[model samples]
Structure formats: C-alpha cells, structure tokens
Target chain A: MLKANNKVLVTISAIVLFFLIAPLIMVIITAFGTDATIAFPIHGFTLHWFANVFAQPDFVAGFKMSLIIALAASLLALVIGVPLVYALTRYNVHHQAWFQTLFLSPTFIPEIVIGFALYQGLVITVQLPLLLTLLIGHFLLCLPYVVRLVTASMVLMDEHIEEAAWVYGSSRLKAFLTVTIPNIRASLVAAFMLCFINSFNNIPISLFLNGPDLSMLPTAILNYLQNNYDPTVSAISVLLMLFTAAMMLLVEKGLGLKALNEM
Target chain B: MKNRSAFLLLLPGVLAICLFLFFPLLQTIWPTLGGSGYSHFLHSGYNRNVLGRTLLIAVITTALALGLGLPLALWIARQKASVKSLLSVVILFPILTNAVVRNFTWIIILGKDGVLNKVLLGLHLTQHPVTLLYTNAAIVIGSVYLFLPIMVTSLIGSVDELNIEVEEAAAVLGAKPWTTLTKVIIPQLTTGILTGSILVFAGAMTAYTTPQLLGGNRHLVMSTLIYQQAMTLGDWNQASVVAVVLIIMTVIVMGLMRLVTRWLDRRPANA
Candidate 1:
C-alpha cells in the first residue's frame, strides 16, 4: 500500500512539474523558430528574434527605465525599511503593533487598488510627476518585505550585545551602526534583492503610472504584445526569467538558502 | 537617548507611510462619500455593476486558483528534493516574468486566430474555432494563471511545515489513504489554504490588466472602472469613488481573513 501510494505521489509530481515547465520550454522553442509567427514544432532555428528584441528601441528604453526605477525604488525602500525594522524590533514603542500593521498594510491590499488609489491621490490631488509617483508606488510595494525580513533577523539576534555596547561607551547611533547593522547584513542584502526583483517585475502599479515617454519594460512589452504577436516578447521573457534566476542564485550563495526560506 | 535614536530611525518610514500610503488611502475614501453624497456615488448604477463584477471575478478567480493550486501544491509537497527544486523554479517562472508579458501571451494564445484555436481547427477537433478571447472565462483563466504561483507558494509553505507522522500513523491504524488525507492532512493545511486563498482573492480583486485585455469592453472590473472614470471620462470624483470602494472592499476582506485566521489560531490545541 505504501509503495503504491509513493508511486502515485511521484506520478502526480511529474505531471504537475511537466505542466508548469512546458510553457517555458515552449517559449524557448518558439523564440528560436525561423517562422515569423510563433508556432509549435519549429521548422528551423535562428537567433533573429533575440536580435530583434535588442534592436527594438522601445524595448531598449523600457529596459533601461525599468532598471533605474527598480534600483531607485529598492534603494529607497531599504533606506526607509532598514531603520523601521530596527525600531520595530529593538525599541519598545507604544502602539507597536499598530505601527507594524500600518507599515505592512501595503502588502495586504491589492496591488491594483493601491495603484489606482495612488494614481488618484497623486496625479489628481497632488500633481506629482509620473516618475515620482512610480517611485512612491514601488517603494510602498517593496517596503513590507524589507521590513519583515530585517525585523525577523533582528528578532533572531541577541539583544544583550547591543545593550552591552551601549553600556560600554558607544552611543545609541554608534551601537546600532556597529552592532545591529552588521548582525542583520544578510537579511538586509536579501531584502534589497527581493525588493529589487519585486519592483522590477511589478506590473499593476507600473501600468497605472507609465506615461508615454516613461514606459517601463514590462509595460512596453505589454503594449507590444497587445498590438503584435511574435516570439520577441517570449525572448524578452526568457531573458527576464534567466536574469531573475541568476539573481536568486547569487542571493542564495551570498545569504544562504535558509535565510531566503525564512523570508 | 535610546528612545530618541529609535524615533529618529523610525521617522523616515513613518513619514513615507503616512504621506504616500495612509494619506492616499484616507483621501480615496472622501470622494466616495463627499462627491455629491455617499448615496449618490453608492447608488450610481454603473459603479454598482463594476463593484459586482469585480467581486464576482475575485471570488471566481480565488476558487479556481485554490482548486488548481491545492492539488499541485500537495503534489509538490510530496516530491523529492531535487525534483522539488526544479518544479519550484518552474512554478515561479510566471511570477518572475513581467505580468504584462504573461497577460499578453495569454492574449495571443486565446485570440481569434491564436494558437489554441488554430490547433483545434488544424486537428479537425471542431467545425470552426470557438471564440475564447474577450470573455469572462478567458479573464478567469489568465488571472488564475497569473496568481496561481502565489497560492502554490503559500500552500507549500504551510504544507511543508506540517508533520507527516500523523498521516502515517492514521494510515497504520487502519485508516484508508483518502480518509487519512481528508481527515488528517487537510485540517492541518487550513491555515495555508486560507492564506493562499486570501492572497489570490486580493490579486484577482485588484487585477487590472488581465480583465482589461481579456474581458475587453464587455466586462468592467473595479480597477478598469476607475481607469475609465479618471482617464476616459475625466471624472476624477467618480474615479475616486470607485477607487475608494475598491479599497474598502479589500480592507474588509483582509480584515475578515485576519479574523478567520485568528479564530483558527485560537482553536483547541489538539484539534
């Protein structure tokens, strides 16, 4: 009976994995197809589609914009998030739970709602620039993960060491810089990369905030795919997936997989 | 001294949250109530339809995601380490891919002369290509495809943490496989299921692109309604009203989720 159950489980696993992986494989296959239209079972193979992806001006501009926005947003999130994480985890603030919830609520709300709300509030009421709006949206979106990871790391660290540093001669700022920052460096790096990936891949907010000239890569690809159907989008997607995977591997190597799992 | 530094450290995040996050949330509520009147915005027939459709799609997408994602997550949970890692990567591909790219891929796949219909016609599977795009079904399919990974990942987190010995012990004590699974494993997985379901529902509720692309002009989810009002109609008040309604609904659902999870957490230890 156990053997039969194990076999059934293995078969189920294989089927699920196959279904999940097949689309990506199909995407890669379609990318290399010599035919203009994307179709299964390629007649010939070529790298012209990938070449096209590079040649497209919109794609190039969008890629650069997405990189800049993602970097800026993640950096801003880290700057705000790291200190917030420190305060929440170390200090006994009044209404700490409320503060935590307030900070983390962005993750709980729907991205679409947040996007729309921010658009209405910023574009309509505040007249914020599109770039600034995008920055604000991405920063809010990525803040929760950074705070959660950093706070978790802080909670795991021994607080006595910080207290000892304070008792010895270091000022609170000096102690935090010398002790807490170094202790949670792994979590901070992980938070930065995670926030970067999320900000980079984010679509809902970008869709709302993307202007004519300031289109992010995802929005550009979206618009392109809407008007045109070809393997160029697939090629771009393949590149994105590989890039993210490479980053994940790098993060794993630097921080350890255990830290990521905790995140 | 410690308190001062802590406050200083927290000031940036707090200020950002207030100015960008909470302030906008509060501002979203006013137009819904303040524009004309609460009843005027609330009773707007067009807004009602948008809200209804948004809720329906959210609920439907959540159900579908749970249906497809649960089985896959369970299957994944039982996989060997090497196989699980590979499968994890595959499952996360849709997530890592730009949402615009994925949704557009669906547009191509489900379009009038797209791959699926073309294949069906080529194989003589049907007399003519069935119209698959620009429909609720297509929206549901695309949204499920988009959000399934979130559900699967959350469920996997819950399932992986569960102790398997209870199921094994139940099996050894003359319980059938189905009986053990239904009675033992699933109850323990409820928290994970709830978390995944809530996340999926939230994603579906706020989904703009999938429905916009796939549902076309026929269907209007809340996000699209807001877009239409603000951008197309140039009615910021109406748009803000819709946006406010979306925010309120999301908050209510999330609050309910928390209540349910808290109840579950407080349940008798053995159960």
Candidate 2:
C-alpha cells in the first residue's frame, strides 16, 4: 500500500512539473520552427526568427528603454529601501509593524491598481511626464522586493558586528559603510537583480504609463503578439526565458533560492 | 539618541512611499468618493457579471493550485537535498519568467491548431480541434499555471514542519492511506492551505495579463474592465470605480493573510 501511495505521489509530481514546463518548452521549440505560423509537429527548423526579432525596430528600442527604466527604478528602490530596512530591523521604533506594513503595502495591491493609481495621481492630476510617471510606477513596483530581501538578509546578519565597529571608535555612518554594507553585499546584489528583472518584465504598469514615444519591452512584445502571429514572438520569448534564467542563477548564487521563501 | 537615528533613517523611504504609493492610491479612490461611480457600477448587469466571473475564476484557480501544489510540495519536501534545489528551480521558472513570455506560450498551446489539439487529434480524443482559447476555462488554466508556483513554495514550509514520526505511527497502526491523510496530514496543513489560497485568489483576482491575453476582450474580468474603461473608452470615472473595487478585494484578502501569519506566531505548539 505504501509503495502504491509513493507511486501515486511521484506520478502527480511528474504531471505538475510537466504542466509547469510544457509552455516554455513549446516556445523554445516553436522559436526554431521554420513555419511562419505555429503548428503541430513543426515544419523545418531554422534560426531566421531570432534574426527577425532583433531586426524589428520596436523590439530594439523597447529593449534599450526597458534596460534604462529597470536600472533607474531598481537603483532608486535600493536607495530608498536600504535606509528603511536598516531602521526597521535595527531600531526599536514605535509602531514598527505598522510602518513595515505601510512600506510593504504596495506589494499587496495589484499592479493594475498601482498602474491606474499612478496614472490618475501623477499623469492626470499632477501632470508629470509619462517617462517620469513610468519611473515612479516601476520604482514602487520594485520597492517592496528590495525591502523584503534586504530586510531578510539584515535580520540574519549579526548586529554585534556593526556595533563592534562602532565601539572601536568608528562613527555610525562609517561603521555602516565599512561593516554593515559589506555584510549584506550579496543580498543587496540579489535584491537589485530581483528588482531589475521585475521592473524590466512588468506589463500592467508599463502598459498604462507608456506613451507612443515610450514603449517598454514587455508591452512592446504584447503589442507585436496582438498584431502578428508569427514565430518571431516565440523567438523573443525564448530569449527572455534565457535572460531570466541567467538572472535566476545570479540570484541563487547571491542569496540562495531558500531566501526567496522568506515571505 | 537611538529613537532619533531610527526616525532619521526611516524618513526618506517613508516619505517616498507616502508620496508615490499612498498618494496615488488615494487619487484612485478619490474620484469614486462621490459614490456615483459605485452606483453606476452596481446598476450595470455587465459589470456585475464581470465581478462575479472574476470571483468565480479566482476561486477555481485557488482550488486547482492547491490541488496540484499539495502533492508537488509534499514530494519536494521529501526529496534529497540535491533533487530538491533542482525542483525548486523548475517551479520558480514560471514565477521568474516575463508575464508576456509566459502567457504567449499559452496562447500558442491553446490556439485552435495548437499543440494540445494536435495531440488530441493524434490520440483521436476528439473529431476536430475544439475552441479552447479565449474562454473562461482558458483564463483559469493560465492563472493556475501562473500562480501554482507560489502555492507550492508557500506550502513546502508547512510540509517540512510536519513531524514524520506521526505519519509513520499512523501508518504503523494499519490506518489506510486515505485515513492517515485526512486524519493526520490535512489538519496540520490548514494554515498553509489558507495562506496559499489567499495568495492565489488575490493573484487570480487582480491578474490582468493572463486573463487579458487568454480570455480576450469578449470575457472581461475587473482588471481588464479597468483597462478597457480607462484606456479604450476614456472612461476614468468607470475605471476608477473598478480599480477601487479591486483594491478593496485585495485589502480583504491581505487582511486575512495577516491574520493567518498572526495565528502562526501565536500558536507554536503544533504536533
């Protein structure tokens, strides 16, 4: 009976894992298919679609813009989030839980809501530029991850190490810079990568904030998919999956995948 | 001195969040303050259907994710260290992949002449290709696929926490597998189940891209309705109303999640 139960468990696990990976494998397979339209048993194989993806002006422009926005947004999130994490984790501030909740509240809300909220508040009411609003949207989207990952790292670090630096006549800022910063470097890198990828891959926020002049990579891909049904998107999807997989490797090396479950 | 430094340290990030996050949320809810948008939304039958459909889909996605996630989590929790990390990566792939890229694959696989139909035709399961894309079922499938990783990751912790000896003892007592599962395994997993359900439900409720790409315009969820009203028809009033409704749904789910976390803290003596 136990053996039979184990077999059932293994079977279910196999099926679920296959379900998770099947779409990704399909995209990868279709990327190399020579046929214009995706079909069963795929026709001849070729790499022309990859070339087509790079040749498209929108994809190129959107990729550059996505890089800029993601870098700026993740950096800003790190700058703003680091101080918040330090204070909350190190100090016994009043209403600390409430403050943490407020800081992390953005993650709980839907990105669609955040996107529309920023649209109404910044673009419509405050009259911010589309690019500025897009940055703010992405920054808000990345902030919680920065705060969460960095906080987890800081919490696990020995607080005494920073105090020891301070006790040795180093000033608070000096100790934080020389001691605390070095301790959390791996997690900071991990957090930045996580934030960068999230901002770059974001769709709803970019969808709402992007104007005709400014297009994000994900939304641009979305637009292309809407108008065209060729394997070029399949090629692009394969490329993105590869990029994200590389980022995941970086994150794993930096902060171990177990840390991601800190939430 | 400590208090002052803490406050100083927190000021910049707090101010940024207040200005960017809270302020915009206030703006979103601002237009609906007159209550006209609420009345307008409530009066429309189509709006009601969208709301109902959104809830229905969320519930279905949550149930499906839990059904699948429990076994996967259990299996992974029991695996050797080397195999566990590999399985973790496999599960994390969907979560880390770009949303557009992930949904694009579903679009192909579910299309009329797509892979699923191809296999079904090959196996003679159906006479002809059936319309699988752009339906409520597609939305549910896409969402479950999208969010199942989260459910599995969350549940693995609780599965790890379960004492193996108890299960061994139950089996030693000649209890049937089903009996051991119901009597021993499930009660301990209640918190995990609740948390996973809340996360998956919230995800499915607010998912814009999956439902947008898979369900198409014919089927409208609240998130898509907000996009359509605000962007397509230029109806900010109606869009704000739907956005506010989504925020409320999120808040309620998040509040439940908070309660679950608090419960986890307060109760440490789980056998």
Best of the candidates, DockQ: 2
Model 1, B81-131: lDDT tens per residue?
Answer: 987786776776567666765666666678787778989998999888788
The residue-by-residue lDDT of candidate 2 on A1-263, one tens digit each, is 12223878889988999999977897898888888787646789899999999999899999999999999999999998999899999999899889888888887889998899898898988998999999999999888888888988899999999989988999989998999999999778878887888899899887788887799889999899889999999899989988988887777777787655654
Off by over 4 Å in 2: A1-5, B268-271
**CA lDDT, every model vs. true structure:** 0.80, 0.88
**Tens-digit per-residue lDDT, B162-195, candidate 2:** 8888888988898876677789887888888888
Best by TM-score: 2
List the lowest-lDDT window of 10 residues for candidate 1 chain B: B30-39
- DockQ score of each predicted structure, in the order shown: 0.53, 0.70
lDDT score, candidate 1, position A91: 80
On the 0 to 100 scale, the lDDT of residue A187 in model 2 is 79
User: Model 2 fnat?
Assistant: 0.78
